[model samples]
Target chain A: MPERRPKIIGFCCEKHGLDCVTLAARSERQYDASVRLIRVPCTGRVDGMHILQALEDGADVVFVLGCLEKNCYYDTGSIEGRKRVEYVKGMLAETGIEPERVEMFNASSSMAWKFHDIVSSMKDVAERLGPIRPKGGGSE
Target chain B: MIVAERKPLDEIAKMIAPYEKVAVIGCRSCVAICLAGGEKEVNMLVSAMRLKNRKDGRKQSLDGFVLERQCEKEWVKEVEEKILDSDIVLSMSCSLGTQTIGDMYPHKIIVPGLNTAIFGVPEEQGVWSEKCLGCGDCIIDTTGGICPIARCAKSMLNGPCGGSSDGHCEVNTDIECAWYAIHERLKLQNRLELMEYVRPPKNWSTSHSGGRRIIVKEDAKLTPHQKRGREVLE
Candidate 1:
C-alpha cells in the first residue's frame, strides 16, 4: 500500500498559530500530514512571489492566514496579503495549475478552530489533487 | 527609487549553466532598496542557484560579491581583475547596473539576473507605486507636487477626465483617482489656481524620447581606467 501523504504548506501569522497548527497535525494522525508551516510577523509579509516560490519549492497546496482585514497593527497588511493572494492565484491559473491550489483566509486571536478546519480541508483537497511534479527532484 | 525584481533561480541557473567559473555581482543602490538585487538577496540567490544546479548534475562555479554601487565603475574597480578572470558574470543588478558593466567591459559575457521595472516609490511595506513614467516632460509643478503623467489612468496632463468619481479612478475601484488626489493636494495648499497655467507641450529631448542621456561634469571625468592607462604605462 502506497502511503499517500498530501504535502500542504501554510503561512501562519503568529507563533501561537504555528504551535496549534503543529499540535493539531500531530494529534490527528489520520492524514499523512507533511505540512510545512512558516510563521511570519504578519501574513502581509507573504508576497505573491513568495507564495509562488513555496509552490515551486513543492507544495501541493498553499494557504495564507492573516489578521482580519483592517485589524492588522501594521496597517492594511491583511489587505496587502489579500491582494498578493489574488495575484498569486491568478498567476497559478496562467501557469496551468488551478488557482484553487492557493487560498487566502482571515483570522485573529483565538481562532484555533478556524485554523484546524482550514488545515483539515486543505489535507482533503491535496489528497484529491495528489502529488505535484516536484521541481528538479530536489526534495525539501 | 527604481523598481526591480529578482530573477527566477532556475532561469538564472540555466544562464550560467555552461560556465564553470561564475562571478555573481549585486548592486547596492536601487535594486538593493527594492530587495531584489541587494546583498542579502545575492547571498540567498547564490545558495539557491547552487543547489538547483547541483541537482541537475552540473557543477557550477559561483562566487557572490556586492558592490557599493554597481552603476559606477569606480566602486567596482577593486574587483575588475577578478571579474575578468571569471568565465562569465551573473549581473544581479537592475538594467542600469547590468548595462554599466557591459559598457565598462565590452568583451566580458554579462548575463542579467534581474528584471528592471520602472521609476517608482514604495507605497508602504513591500508595495511600490510607479510615480514617474520617465516621459519626456515635467509638469508636476502645476499638478501641486503630484504626478499626473504616472498616476492618472489615462496619463492626462490637464485635468481629470469625466471617468473619475469620488476621487477614485474608473480604471479600478481600488486605485485612487490620481487627478483627484492632485486636486485635493492643490486645494489644501491654496495653489489650486496653478491649474489654469497651461504649460507648453513637453520637449521630447529632455526625456527618453530623445536619445541616450549624458551628464557631463568637470569633477568626475576620465574614469579610473582612462586615468590609470595615461599615468602608469610610461
Candidate 2:
C-alpha cells in the first residue's frame, strides 16, 4: 500500500509574494502541486496561536511564505514572521515535535521562478517527516 | 494578600488526566495581583493541555474561565455555568480559593494548580517572598515596618543575632541582618534604651496552628439601627 501524503499548509503574504509560487508552478515543470495555500495581508499578522492551531488541526507541514527580507512592502512583516516562526519552533521541540515541520520562506514578487523551486524543495522535505503532534506535550 | 506559584505542568497535566472535559479556572483577586493565578495563566495552561491531548489521540476537550475572587462564595458563583459542563475543575488560585470551589460544588472534583505561599508583597515584577508568616499577631509597628519572622533568617523575635556583623547575617553574608535593621531604627529614634528590654518568644498558637482564628465583638458586630429594623439591603 502507498503511504499517505502529508498535509502541507502554506501561509503566504498577500501584499507582494502570495502568487509568486503559483505562477512559478504553472510555468515550471518541477513545482509541487500538493500544498494548500492561505493568503494573508502579511506574515507579521501571524500570531503564535495561529501556527499552533494549524498543527492542532493535523497539518503535517506549515510554511510561512513572505517577501524577501528588506524587500517586504509592509516594512518588517517578513522579519516579524521569521521571529514568530523561531518562537514556535522552540515550543514544538518541548512537545516532541520536530522543529523542521514549521518553516518560513522569503521570495520576491518577481521571483516567480525561485518560488517554484522553494515549493518543490518544501514538498521534498515534508515527504521525509511524518505527522506533527500538538504544541504542549506528545510524541509521533 | 496571599502569594502562590503554579505547580509544574507535568504534575498539573496528571491531575486533570482522568477527565475528558476539563475547565481551567483562574482567580483574579489575590492570585492575580500576586501574578500567579490569573486569566493569562489559565489561557496558557489550557492551550498546553489541549496540545498534549491532541498529541495523545485521546480526544480531550478543554476550556478556560476566571472568576474575580475565588475565595468568596459570591465571586465563585459567577462561573457556575462553565463549571457545570466540565468533568473536572483545575483552579489556579490560592489553596483557600481551591477549597472554596470544592466546598461549593461537592459533586465535582476541584483540583489546586498552585502551591499557596504565605502573605507577602511583590519583591519585584515576578518575585514575592514570605513577608508575613501570619504569626497571629502583627508587629509591623514595633519592628519598624519589617516582619522579623519573615525577613530574619531565624524568624527571631528579638533579632540581629550575635553573628550579625557589619550589618550582614552570619548564616549568609549576602543577607542583611534583621536585628541590624531594628537597631538602626532604634538608634535613629533615640530609643536605643528599648533594646535593653528582653522580648518573649513568639506565640504561634494564635496563628493557623490554632485551627482558624476568629475575632468577634458584640458591640462592633452590627449597627444599632440595622439590628432593630431587621430589614436587609437588596
| Most accurate candidate by TM-score | 2
Number of the top-ranking candidate, with lDDT as the measure: 2
Candidate 2, RMSD to the unseen true structure:
7.0
Candidate 2's residue-wise lDDT over B1-234, tens digit each?
798987876678788888889888898988988867887667656765676666665677888889988999888888887887899999999999889989999998999989998788877866776777877788766766777888788988876678899999888898788878888887888878666656687678888877888888977787878776755552
In the order shown, the candidates' DockQ scores are 0.08, 0.17
Residue-level error in angstroms, candidate 1, position A139 = 14
Candidate 1's TM-score: 0.64
Predicted structure 1: lDDT? 0.76
| Alpha-carbon shift of residue A53 in model 1 (angstroms) | 16
Please give the distance, in angstroms, between residue B199's alpha carbon in candidate 2 and its true position after superposition: 1.5
Colliding residue pairs in candidate 1: none
What candidate 2 keeps of the native contacts, as a fraction, is 0.14
